[model samples]
Target: MQTSPENDLVTIEEAAAMLGTTTVNILMNLKRNLLQGQEIDGHWHVSKASLAAHGGDTKAAVSKPLCQRSTCGSCGQH
Candidate 1:
């Protein structure tokens, strides 16, 4: 992936494009508290770090486990 300076504050639309997702999806993530953001100028803003850490999907970072599950639903096999 190309590295470019990101806007200090990015809107849902811009984030969605950068993350290769839909605005609705991004919005949902924000609503579910899956993504880290702040309300500035009456708009939500996401950090570049948050996006990069989650592979553009912050929810996946927290909700999904590192390993595939065969026994334990949250992570690896028992």
Candidate 2:
């Protein structure tokens, strides 16, 4: 796809750093469609535009635990 300097693809790590968050959080955002990105050969590439948009949604880079937000099935305690 066509990419500009401001909209170039960034690795999950780089995206996380840019957002001051974690790679796992970025991956979860990707999975939940909370962020925009694509998987290439099993590696995730994030869109800079998407990252910029998400910036307003967060005040800080704190990561939330799954069970803290809603009923989580992963741990089976919720």
Per-model tally of clashing residue pairs: 0, 0
How many clashes does the backbone of model 1 have?
0
What local lDDT score does residue 12 receive in model 2, on the 0 to 100 scale?
85
Instruction: Write down the TM-score of every candidate.
Output: 0.55, 0.65
Estimate candidate 1's RMSD in Å: 7.4
Deviation of model 2 at 9, angstroms: 1.2
* lDDT per residue as tens, model 1, 1-78: 332234555777777777776776666667666676777767767766667778645455544542333543434344
Q: Name the candidate that leads on lDDT.
A: 2
How much does each candidate deviate from the true structure in C-alpha RMSD? Answer: 7.4, 5.2
Candidate 2 lDDT over 1-78, as tens digits, reads 344334568888887777777798788878877678887777888888777875554415224444455664533566
- The TM-score obtained by model 1 is 0.55
In model 1, which residue pairs have backbone atoms overlapping below 3 Å?
none
